[model samples]
Target: MSTPPASAGTGIAASRWRHLPVGALETVRGNLEDALLAGLLALPVTFAAAVLGGLVGEELMEPSGPATTLDLTSRASLAAVAVLAVLGVLARGLVIALRGVLMARALAAAVRAGTPPTEVPAPLQWQHAHERSDRAYRRTAIILLVILGLCFGVVVPAAVQEPFLSGLAIIVAGAAVLGLIALGIPLTGTVLRRRQLALLGPVDGHWTQAHRIIAAGHVLTGDAVAAARAGRPERGHPGSAARRLGKVATAVVGVGATAAYLGFQVVAALAFPDRQRWAGGLPGERADLGPEAERMVDLAVTVCVVGGAVAILALVVGALAGLAERTQEQAALRRALVEGAAPPPYPVLQRYLRRRSAPLLRMVSALVGVMLVVGGTLVVLDGVVDAPSWGSFAGAGQGLREATGLGPGILGLALGVAALEVALASLLEARERRLRDAVVQRWPVRPAPGG
Candidate 1:
């Protein structure tokens, strides 16, 4: 309704960077660049250490324990492994640090520029993570939808032919996702920059939907002040910054994770110095030494660890698989609409559906998580609670038969139950909301899209 003074926008942008003195932008950028460098430098070494990769960075000195002379004549190899483990630790620290630096830089930039940032607001961040939680709900909704056109939909069912290959597929799928993000990041930035001028918002925090374009413009400046006060999606502010940080963080984390694995191996090796050569149980050839129960326990631990890894990967897939479904189904709908077929249902339906399922779904998710933890804890407890006497469980070998087996079986069952719980709760919640709509006087319901 009125033309604001020219100084208004300038003041808003200035408020974004009160800490910025002379060349603060340059400083922020340099610090960010250095953090990125630290991340890159740390990656390979961290990964090597994590994987127990024998590629050594140092020579082994004599260890104080009996492990010093156990079977491996090469202390050199042992030292090399130790060095790798240390490297992994260092890399992990660097990665987290780098990610923080990236976040700070992006926040700083947004503050200076008076533009919004992209990270979902804290309130809705859960749903923004998309497929991160519910496998069953996504499966029920997306499977039927995605399957409508076999040509576009066959990949998922086709991949089920071999469960072993599914992990590799998940990893590959993750990589492709990264690739798409990489491709889109710059394009998104370009779109925002071009549209910057058309957008304008009051510098104050009071503006709502009527002020979105202005908020979008403020977000573009990467100005933290406007961003915090702004309501619209921060969109571009941290997107690029986050991308840079992720690479650094992943390398760092990979190293730490790999080092943990190696440490476990070394610990195991040390515990059973003659593990490969020594007969497992009944050292003196006693008749009562070996038992099937011991064997059962060992199997459990092995399964849990292996299953945990699978669960971790599945977690990633479960987290991302929703986004994939979102993207794929959205794409399919677009195609159908383009083909002049019965128009695909309103795209908003999918979003609302997800939004609506939010609470009950989250409850289910929490339920499942609790279940997994309880189950896994029980398994781990059983192993610790009753490890058979050394040399008693002859065929089972200490830990080889008992500890590993018992730990995982219980954990696996818990995970499955957890998954089921999240799905069922979501379904129930949706049903309850619909039935209670009249009685509740239209208590606001979340859409299935979450945000």
Candidate 2:
């Protein structure tokens, strides 16, 4: 083997290193004003949130009666709150910063493509689009990770220790966050898909070209196209005997799982003693688990209910996505056959659906991860901290230890949240793999090329 000259080798290595920072520098250069604004906005918010948190923590950790002076434990507790507040504010800042950067890049791309600012960016080649999409996916994921870290490490844990009314208030805040995430993820996905489709506009007029684009984009199978062309049934379609059976099996499995989970929920509810007079019947007639136990049960039920709701929502989304996919695939095949491989101008509806073939599971996973972090942190903090009055954080640590038996401890909450995230991630990943494999398997068994 011959080695390259030293100058040539050095130049190559140096070029690669130089390119590494170009993207970042470009982003910063494009969004310099927004970046500065983000920095400016972040400081005050961070300081305000942290200082407020510290003050709140000081009040919580104050002695039972009148206490003018702070103790060591109290000071430490205040510091924890301050740290969490800083994290939350910083997370928000990061979101602002990242959004600014994305917007700037998108604007630049649009200009380069000569598309109107109001209209979406034209879709790039599928390969290029896919690469950019992967990068976007990773960036979006990092933003979500930051949100989760803030929620789990700061907001929920810090806020949930308030009085009953305040606790409810914070829980509502957490729910609002979840709602935002659910809405945001789907909206982002729709925008991305629309942009991709817009990019494919030039090829829209030709059916043959569009067919190849769709196939190359992994939107439809060649076999499906062939079957459609010949006016025959597409093999392995849902209408097929095996697929129909599979559908039935899937429904049965889903129903069984739902029933089992419902049963478990019922059993859990019954197992917990009813303490409130309104809940059971008469005051003395209802058995009361100590106040702590009751609170713990309430927290557990809330977590379970929220988790269940998320699962149901995910299933609904998955079902809708699957239906949409099948419809699009059939429509693409139909258009291809009917048009006789006409050049360009693919059906707009079919093209839209085809371009959006990427799974929503990953985005949904990120949303769920954020929700779990917030919910789990809230539940754990509620169990551990008892902020009866202004300053009561000093005793919270002790309360946390005692409440361990009543509620799922901090460790258990963390573990449960982690497990849920893992399960959802694994399920989605497997689904994506199966889908890719099925598409790959759809290649024609025998080629009629150059015929």
List TM-scores for all candidates, in order. 0.22, 0.28
Taking the tens digit of each residue's C-alpha lDDT, what string does model 2 give over 22-94?
A: 1333233223323223333333322323333332333234443223222322233333334334443433343
Among all windows of ten consecutive residues in candidate 2, which has the lowest summed lDDT? 13-22
Clashes of each: 60, 23
Which number leads on lDDT?
Answer: 2
* Candidate 1 worst ten-residue window by lDDT: 14-23
Off by over 4 Å in 2: 1-108, 114-250, 265-270, 273-451
Candidate that would win on TM-score: 2
Please, what are the lDDT tens digits per residue for candidate 1 over residues 215-242?
A: 2343222143243335643333212333
